[model samples]
Target: MTPEERSLRARLAAHVSWAATPDPASRTAKARAAADSKFEREAREMHPDASDEHIARVAKHLRSAHFSRMALKAAARRRNSATPKAA
Candidate 1:
């Protein structure tokens, strides 16, 4: 109940509220959905005889791998941008 603690709590609450808002129409959101569907389809095609559980697992793995790769690339881009460029 210190003033500084209250301010921090308010800012954190605001951030959490803002972050929880969903935007289904955003391009990135749509792209992510499309990618997820594509992964599921690809998994199904690759293992036509597999059980639903297996296919779902494969699709989940594919989506996770894809996003992890994207995150790595984004981090690399940020690192490169922050580095001083040679004249």
Candidate 2:
């Protein structure tokens, strides 16, 4: 291979290594997953009579568990409207 090709390959390898770093947020999700899974299992078990659509709706809310990005943005907009601008 040419020197230019070798240099490009090394840079790409380094970028891939950096990108693969484990994000801490993923670990937090992993910790929460056990509890969340148990909740889902129990919900299905206790409400075997409930419709799939209802279960899916409840599951969506459960999955969010907190303010999502869109919700945050909407909140920010509301706060902005309530605040006075500085001169």
Judging by TM-score against the true structure, name the best candidate.
Answer: 1
CA shift at 62, candidate 1, in angstroms? 0.6
* lDDT tens readout by residue for model 1, 1-87: 999999999999988876876853573787878888899999999899999999999999988888999999999999999999999
Per-candidate alpha-carbon RMSD to the true structure: 9.4, 12.1
Q: State the lDDT of candidate 2 residue by residue for 58-83, as single tens digits.
A: 66575675447679889999999999
Best by lDDT: 1
Q: How far in Å is the alpha carbon of 85 misplaced in model 1?
A: 0.8
Pairs with steric clashes in candidate 1 = none
